[model samples]
Target: MIQNSGIGRVLYETLLYLLDNGDEWILIGNPEFLKQLPGKRNTIVASHAPAFHPREFVGFPRRIINSADVFFTPNYNIPGGIRVPIVASILDLVYFDLPEIVRSPVGRWIRRYFARRAVRLSREIITISEFTRERIEYYLKPGVPIHVCYLGITRELRNQRADFLRGPRPYDFPYILYIGNVKRHKNLHVLLEAYLTARKNDFNCKLVIVGKMEGLRTRDAGIMREFAQLEKQGDIITSGYVPDNELYQLMAHTEVLIQPSLYEGFGLPPLEALYLGRPVVLSDIPIFREVYSDLPVTFFDPLSVRQLSAILENHSWETPTSIDTTLKSRELDYAAAAEKIYSVLKKYAG
Candidate 1:
C-alpha cells in the first residue's frame, strides 16, 4: 500500500490499471491510504509504513522475490535486502540536484541513500518526464532503463462543470489559480511576491492558492505568515486542501494556472489545467520545457519575482486544442504501461 500523497495517488492509479487488466497486486502502506483502495478480492492491503521510515522487513512476502514477481515502489525508497525485481519510480534527484533546497541533514541522507538503492535494485525505472529521466541517468549509473510515463488528468476533471454561478464571487473576480503544497521547492514565497508586485500595477486578478499546508519548514512557515497577513488585507485567498469538485470548478473557470516550482519530475497541476482547457503559466525550468514545449504554456523564471509578475500581467487565456489529444495519448500510454508491467511480472512469476 502506498501512502496517500502525490506519488501515492499515481501508484494507486497505476495499480488500478494493472488490476483492471487482470493482474493481482498487494498494496503495502499507511492504513489511511490503504483504506482508499477498492475492496476487491485481488487487492491486499499490507501494514502501514510511515513516510521516509525504513520499510519493515517482518511480514508476509518475507522473501521479497517470493512475495511478488516485480515489486513496484513509487517515489523512491525500497526495502533493503529485497532480492525482488524492484521497479521504482524516481521522481527527481532534487535533494542532490538542488541541495540548497533540502533543509535537514537526516532528510538529505535518507533521500540520497534510497535514490542510490533505487538505481541499484530497479530492473526497470519509471519517471514522470524525460528531463527527470536524464537527471536520474546523470546521477546514477548509466544505461539503466528509464521509462517516461507522463501523468494524466483524470477524466472527472474534463466532465466538470464550470459552476461559477454559486461560488462566493460568481464571476465577480478574475482569479489566477495555483494548486499544490507550499513547500520550499514549490516556491510559493516568490509566487506570492510576484502576485503582489503584479497587483501593484493594477492587475485586477485575484490569486487563489489551493493545497494542504504540510512540510512547511519554519522559514517557509514564516513567509506564509506574511502572506497570510496580506491575505487578511485581501491580496490572496488561500483555500487550503479544497475538495476535488471545488478544485476542478476553479480550474475550469480560472484565467490561468500558475506553477512556479523550482523543480518537478512532472508537474501534474499544469496538465490538469490543460485538460480543463485552461491556459498555464509555468516556471521556465528545463523539465517544464521538456514536457510542455509542444504545448502553449507561458514560462517564467521561478527565481525572479519580476519575471513572474511580467508574465502574469501580459498572459492571456486561450482554450487549447491539444488537450483532448493529450488526454487520449495518456490513456494509450497508461494501457501500454500496464502491459509492460504485467509482462515483467509474468517473466518472473513464481
Candidate 2:
C-alpha cells in the first residue's frame, strides 16, 4: 500500500482480512503510511528505496527483519525486496494487453523483468481474477501455482439509503456514470465518441466521469484533449473523486454505469453496480464475461464507436432496463479467499 490507488485499497482489504483471520501477522512498508493502518503492534517499517522497484535487486536491507517464514504481499513485490519463497499478488499484465501504453522500451522490459523475477521467486502467485492468472500464464509461464480471489464490495455500500435525490448531484439530469481514473488504457475516448453518437438519437443522458482530476499521469494527451472538449460542450461532466458514500449512491441512481476499459485485473465498477442493482455497459472483454457470467450486463466492442452508441441509445431514462437484483457478485467469497491464502502460507511458513 505505497500510495492511495486501487492496489493500495486492495492491500488495505487484505490487511483487514488477515487481522481478523490469521495470527501473528506482520506488515512491512513505509512507516508514515502503513503505520497509520490499525494493528500497529505487528507493523515493521523497514527503510527501503523511495519506490518499490527492482532497485531492491541491487540490495535488500534485511537487518531490520527479526524472523519471518512466508512473505505474503498483497501486491506484486514484497517490501524490502525479498527474493525468496512467497505468495505475491499481481494485479494486471496490462502492459502486455495494451503495449502501446507502455511508452518506453526500457520501461516495458523492466516491468517484464520484474514480473518474471517476482513469479520465479514466489512459491505461488495470487491474481484478482482467473483472467489475470491466464494472462500471467500466457506471458510469464511461471510453474508456480496461481490463485484467483475476488474483492468484496466496499462497506460504505451497506450504508446506502434511498436518499440519492437529496444528496448533492454532479449533474441535474439523468447521467451515465464512469468511475475510476482517466488513463490511456481505459479507452475513454471510445466512451466519448459513443456518447456523442448516441446524443444524436436523443439518448438524453449526460456522461459523468468521476475520479481524482489533479496530479494524474496523463498517458495519452489526445484523449485528455478530447475529454476537455466534451466537458466544455457539457456532453460529459467530470466529478473529480466523489466520496464513497456519495459515489455508491450515485451508482444506485445512475441510468447505467459504463466501463470502457480495454484491460483490467477485475473491474470493480460493474461489481459495485452489481450491489447497487444498476445495469452496466462493459467492453466486450473476456474478464467481464468470466467474472460476471451470472450477471446480465450489456457488452459493447471497445474499439467500435457504433456498437457503444447502439448500447447507449438503447439505455435511456424513458425506457430504463430492468437491473436483475439477483445479479450479485461473489464478494462474500472473501472468507474463502482468505482461507486459501492462509492455507498456502501455513504450508510454507516454517
Candidate 3:
C-alpha cells in the first residue's frame, strides 16, 4: 500500500525537492505511487514486494541496482545482495526501543537483525532527530558516521498562507485534534482514557483523531474498548485519512492539538500546529523536549490521566506568539534537508 504520512511523507517531500532541483534517481516500490512525482529523467522500477518481506532480498531488478552509484533507503529495510555503497536511514529505533510492541519473539529478533544489518551494511546512516541520534549511538553503537538531518516541515504546510483562516467546521462541535497512527507507543489508549475523564469533568469538546482505524481492534484490544465506548456515544470521531488542505483546516480550527505519545523520534503534528500558530499540548517526553522546548507549548505527563484531563478541561494555554516567524527562519524547509542528504550521497557515490 502507498504510505502518505510519517516517514513516507518525509521521504516524499525530500525526493520531490531532489527531483525538481536536479538528480537522476532510480526509484523502486509501487510505480503508481512514485510516478506522480516530477522528473522523467529519473527511472521508476516497479516492485510489488513490501519492505521486510523475504522476496525483497532479491526483488529489486538487477539492472536498476547495477546502474546506481550509491543506494540510500529512507528506512532500515536494506535489500539483500546489493553491491553498491548503501546509506540507510534509521528514523527511530521503534522496534528496538519498544520491543514489547512486536508480540512475537521471532518477529522481534528479525527486526533487530535487520536493524543491525542496516548499520553494518550502510556506508553511512541518516537519522531525523538528535534524540534518535543519541538512541542509535547508545543502543546500536554504529561506528560509521551518522548524520543528523532534522526533518523539515513539508512544502504544503510551509507554503500555506499565513492568514489562512480556519474554513468550515470539520465537525459541528468543538474538538481537540490528534493526527497519527494508532500504534502501541502512540499511547492513544491513555489519550482516550484521559479524554473520557475530561468529559466527566465537563470538558465539552469532541476528540477528533485523524488516521486510519482499520484493524485497531485486533492490534490493541484495550484501546479498542475505550474507543468503541467513546465512539458509540459520539464523543470520539475518526477521520480515516484527510487530504492536506482538509488536515490544515482541521488543525487550524481545532480547540487545541494534543500529542500524547509515550515515545517518538520526533513528533511532527505538534510542530505543524506550532507553525500554524495553534495551541498544542505535548507529552513530556525526552524527544519532545529536545526538539520543541524552545517553542511555546504545554507539556503533560503521558501516563497521568488526571493531569491531562484537567488541562483539557481548563484550556489554560494560549496560542503561541511569533511562532510562525520563528519556525519560518528555522529548520522548516525540506529543500535544505534534501541538499544536506544529497551532499552526503555525493561524498560516497562511486
Candidate 2 lDDT tens digits, 22-92? 36656656777666555534756554553445555445454443356777766654545464467788989
* Model 1 misplaced stretches (Cα beyond 4 Å): 1-3, 30-43, 55-65, 158-172, 213-226, 316-319, 329-333
Count of steric clashes across candidates, in order: 2, 1, 0
Q: List CA RMSD, all candidates.
A: 3.5, 3.9, 2.5
Supply candidate 1's per-residue lDDT for 53: 68
Q: What is the lDDT of residue 266 in candidate 3?
A: 81
Q: Show where candidate 2 strays beyond 4 Å.
A: 36-41, 46-61, 78-84, 159-170, 212-230, 316-332
Task: Estimate, for each residue in 179-275, the C-alpha lDDT of model 3 and write its tens digit.
Answer: 8887788877777878887887898999999997754643456656867888988889888898878898788788899998989988888877777
Candidate achieving the largest lDDT: 3
Order of quality (TM-score): 3, 1, 2
| TM-score against native, each model | 0.85, 0.84, 0.92
lDDT of 3 at 235: 85
| Ten-residue region with minimum lDDT total, candidate 3 | 161-170
Q: Distance (Å) between predicted and true CA of 240, model 1?
A: 1.8
